[model samples]
Target: MHDITHRNRAESPSSKTLFKATAIALVVGAGLLVTTVLPAEYGIDPTGVGGYLGLTQLNAIAPQETAEPVEDPMISDAQLASLLNPVWKSSAPLRNDTLTITLGPNEGAEIKAQMQEGDRFMFKWEAQGPVNFDMHGERPNAGDEFTSYWTGRNKTNANGAFQAPFEGVHGWYWHNGGAQPVTVTVTTTGFYEKLYKL
Candidate 1:
């Protein structure tokens, strides 16, 4: 039988040597703290080397991220509101329509514009005499199912804007309520496909 002995011959480091190595490491850590960590994380570039190396930019960016941007005073309130609260955009072109309708006593008529969902329109109408009116919308092919926006009795005029909640025909139904006939003229400008008597 043969016996083999293997052992590590290197001596354990001396306390003096270990202390010297620890001091060297401490010096390097302090150097890095002054040159990099202080400027990059806290904007403290006492040695100016961190600023020269562009490490201060990191701390500069932190404040900018926490700060709210200053809004320009030249912007109008409406412009600012539009920026903060965006509006719907449609592919439809801008158009205008002026419709003059005459209704005999106790008679009714409708004038509407075909609008897709999110379309907007402005309308103004005046009647020679007071008439009852209803502003409503109808979805395509949805017979008898409609959304009424406004209604009034014996109104001589009306003016307002509308945003379509769904794809539909939207407009006014005015009924002559007086003993005599009434003539109503309606003007509309907006992003609608067509306007016609229905």
Candidate 2:
């Protein structure tokens, strides 16, 4: 009976040791599998957070501006004159068809004969004399003799003629109903006398 009891105790200890070794091996293998697979799928890691899933934090980029094309304005005196009127031929006696200067009193400038969208003309007076005129409801002041003139919206002694920026309608009326006969000269071409674009 004593020998049998001793043998039973030895066998019991061996069985318990084998069971513990098997349990420890299974736990270690499961931990290795979770560490390798869980980080790639759930973005979770034992050591780091974002680096586990290969993600990085960066700043947002802004959009850039695009380049566009521009078109130039059409400039042609003959074309402008034709746009104003085709049949209104320039008088051979008058040197300039853009404007006709009448040096006598109570005489109006015959601009209606050759007025056009691009027809820019000027009426410069040799002497400042009393002149009356109307343009788009804005008439020239009385007793103001102008030296050098343009048929544009703004008037000054800068240039001798009006400049047509583009194809647009414009008009001017003048009367030399003063005491002396006014001698006015005019010149017109395809040159733009003012800066319209900035």
> Evaluated with lDDT, which candidate comes out highest?
1
List TM-scores for all candidates, in order.
0.58, 0.26
Residue 192, candidate 1: alpha-carbon lDDT: 92
Clashing residue pairs for model 1: none
- Write candidate 1's Cα lDDT for 1-198 as tens digits: 533345343555778899999999999999999999999999999999999999999998744345665686488889888888876677999989998989998999999999999899999999999999999999999999888999999899999999899998999999997789899999999999988997
Expressed as tens digits, the lDDT of each residue in 46-92 for candidate 2 is: 65543543531211123466766446466588878778885533322
Candidate 2: residue 157 Cα off by (Å): 5.7
For model 2, the stretches where C-alpha displacement exceeds 4 angstroms are 1-100, 112-128, 135-171, 191-198
Clashing pairs in model 2, backbone N/Cα/C closer than 3 A: 129-145
Q: Rate the local accuracy (lDDT) of all candidates.
A: 0.91, 0.44
Poorest 10 consecutive residues of model 1 by lDDT? Answer: 1-10
Q: Note each model's CA RMSD in angstroms.
A: 19.7, 25.2
